[model samples]
Target chain A: MTAALPDTKVLSPGNPPLSPARIVVLGQDTPFRLDSGVELGGFRIAYQTYGTLNADRTNAVLVCHALTGDHYVAEKHPVTGKPGWWNLMVGPGKPIDTDRYFVICSNVIGSCMGSEGPKELNLVTGKPWALDFPVITIADMVRAQRLLVEYLGVDQLFCVIGGSMGGMQVLQWAVSYPDKVYCCLPIATAARHSAQNIAFHEVGRQAIMADPEWCGGDYLNKGTKPTKGLSVARMAAHITYLSEAALHRKFGRNLQDRKAVTFGFDADFQVESYLRHQGISFVERFDANSYLYITRAMDYFDLAADHGGVLANAFQVTGPDGKRTGTPVRFCLVSFSSDWLFPTSESRAVVHALNSVAANVSFVEITTDKGHDAFLLDEPEFYQVVRGFVDGNAERRGLAARVG
Target chain B: MAGHETNGHIRPDLERIVEWVQPGARVLDVGCGDGELLHALVRRKQVDGRGLELSMDGVRCSVGHGLPVIQGDADTDLKDYPSDGFDYVILSQTLQATRRPREVLEHLVRIGRYAIISLPNFGYWRVRMELLLRGRMPVTDRLGHQWYETPNIHFCTIRDFITLCDDAGISIERSVILGAGERPLPHPAASARANWLGEQGLFLLRRN
Candidate 1:
């Protein structure tokens, strides 16, 4: 049931065994039944661990990665040679102190960084899944993570946390297994994808599909990659991650390596140059088809819709006989002031729903001009909020702290 | 009354406020300074406490102590909170500092089942004596700043607060007075003597 694929090593050539982390492979007998009703037979998950699981395994924290992020949560990324995406908040004495808690971050199912995605080979077809890959939802991603956690032999998670798409997964994890998650932290995320967000994702998908090199989502078989389309998609999506004030403060009409505008179609502004660099770097690391699948999954995520249109119903824990259990996972929601994509209003809606059900919850909207990406940056207020919430929950869980 | 110790001593007014809060009730403390009262309630009464702090440092300090608090302005943010979302909404010594004291009072009663408010009384004997003798706005220990520098723009006496509550159709369920040292005053409830002698006024009110 758990046999390894013969072509697993050659499947993701670009990944190249970057981080010294564990990679688990699940076979046909242990298939991942996705929301699309398609069963994914053989798949692999790459993950990194920090700190140590306590003797009772009560110190485990699952950190979900965002859309373009990988399992390298607090170390150097093997491919780009850049510092881990969340290094500012996941080190010794940091907000999510690895010294006190065991952290697990896995590259999601539809991601390309050493995970089961469109880039992985289909055991039946003996080729990449590509367009043939079943569309996955946020719930499917959490289901895969649950498997990973169970395989690691941890019965319960002390906390599950993430921001943006990762936060969506955290919410799904809490709802799907209310008793298993002790504390939930979903930052800068919504219970459902807004129409505007879905529209933006549609544009990105269209950009990739427009490229001739896409070759009907079979670029790998044709020995070509849709780098240009993927770059355009990344460039457009990256703009939403920042606020106008931050763009003005950083680049603001300044020329790019020139004293004056080129007066041509070239990148004449510093902002344009920066976005171009971001798009180029993104294409080098991400697969075009994988982006399409991941964005689609996010667009289809609506936690309340799956549970009779009542958001509180999504948090209800039921027994095997389908009776109410009356136990809820504690939640702490956070949002930034300037995050237009997933604003504070969305977090408030979640809080209001939790209140209706009498769930133990806390919410804080940190004042920041860093936009949606503020969660990834070194915002002092954000760090203090996370540290406080995590430490408080840890105390309540009776997990021993690391003494100085 | 059991005093919740933080820095080895509980501010007497805060101890009184904690006593008013029922154990296991959901409380929202508006303008919670450093979340001291909420912290005490959570530790002593085991209440589900939340805080809305206006100052960044206060929010940080509250969060540093692992208290749930959001950095927000009372005058604007209160409208966003759902009605009857909390069992008790407490505004401790921040009413006069708000841009719209009357509107803020209305929001407190609207958002919580009971609104617990504690405010400095401007009609205290020391404030009156200083104003009559010196012919200027008083500078007592409670109201220390001069008029030009004071944040208490809409400062009121106990009588004035009662009249405003009556005008707004709100019912005062209970009231208490505290002297200059933040200890309970022996004056009878709703008496003119309490207005003059009491340095602070604590009221529990609800919508009529």
Candidate 2:
């Protein structure tokens, strides 16, 4: 391991202790080779596990976090004191039931929240990597996850699940290591980022970079935080996560704590106040440079490009007869009705590709006005579909149900 | 005629249709309501089965049963599917509800080596009797709605379907007519007497 920075506190304030978070440090001998061809001498991964690994370790399920998500999937986030991001969907007797399966969640490499990211010390320079950190891809994130899974002494995962960027990692896992994953559930995600999505990400990146306090990604070294820029970026991106219908139903044109509009450009409207709150609260626990790196990773994701131009080529698994017998990995894809970001058509395209390869796959387009964020909400139908898929796949895998 | 025993009840038409489907075949059940036939095929025939349903609730119910089903319109979505995609394509009791029955039939033949179709016969004696005697649209157990509220807009008889198949250059591999109570007719389905007496028609077809 390299020397720790003397003033690590200068990079990020309110740094929580790493007690609840299980940290794994990979040394130079087992360096994590990134898609950008640059690798760190040493780095650490912050993860959290729920449920106990069965005696045979066959019940392990790895849950990948989305762009802004961390390892706090089924517990209160240490930094925000808010319930876990997916606590509604994962818990005892829940869809991803802890009583039946072992669950593991890890903060991706290009993220904050104790994971090795732009805010972490570079070890060689004894300073935060910041802009100097190499650009990573979705594949890189999955590769890092594979390392973590291997570290846990699990030969194969019973299931790998995620939504949005986390969903991309699930796809990458199926493509990169087909035999390792028994079941994959990718919700509201695509094989590649759409042009419109990339455009939106670009706007967020520019907002962070344009901030005067950013100081060429050396804000940490200069003892300045790009709160305004990061907040603006979060506010802009949050709008895309929701639908116009949802926004209308949620806030509409209602005034915020006033009888009439102030007309002074302050948060007079409820929607404006809501966006402002979302932005301000986002900057509290997130790092600006990490956002830039992670968004770039999502933009570079195009699984089909890696395996020729045909999307079906990504799922080609040869059998003993030397014929394309399709992949053994069973997949369940889901999309939301009002999600313009990743619409139902995108999920259908993925299903079509899987069909072309004759792969075992299922698809569901949930009717909801909740947009892309519906996966994160308490949608009963989504829960039912997930529970059915997981339980059915578990039975097929001969996993005995755990008695209470 | 042995009835197709399902939950102790005999559905001869569905049983006759199931008999034509080869074991371990790849099947796509278009307009599969609640996926009863597809599930039975998967369980009994050991065939790899998929389904396309029009109603959201039906899709949900089928998926809840662990069936691979997508909510899609048979009229428009069928054209997008690749040709020769499955060994068998089935459209059960949903032909009259489709906007373009002939087009859907063409797609079924193109997408699958064999197509199985089942429909309620509008020319059955009881239906004709209700129309002629009461001077109104028939409302029987099979056609269970008033004309204004009925979903069966393109209802056709066994004779009308045979003529349509002939015009479209589709060859009927086999045909079976069921009585008013879903019992198989004793005579051949092609005979004119059977068409007037039979309440339902099941046909297995292939492209010429």
Best by TM-score: 2
Q: How accurate locally is residue B152 in candidate 1, as Cα lDDT from 0 to 100?
A: 86
**What is candidate 1's lDDT per residue for A295-375, written digit by digit as tens?**
998999998999899887787677688985433687778899999999999887887666555466667878889999999
Q: How accurate is candidate 2 locally (lDDT)?
A: 0.85
B1-208: candidate 2 lDDT, tens digit per residue: 1121254343566667678899999999999877777777877788888888888887777776677777778998787667887899999999999999999999999989999999999889999999899998899988999999988889998999999999999999998889867878887777887889999999999999
Report the C-alpha lDDT of model 2 over A25-144, residue by residue, as the tens digit.
754467678888987766788887776677777887899889899999877788899878998777777778776787888999879988788999987899998899888899988887
Q: Judged by lDDT, which candidate is best? A: 2
- Which residue pairs clash in candidate 1? none
Error of 1 at A291 (Å): 0.3
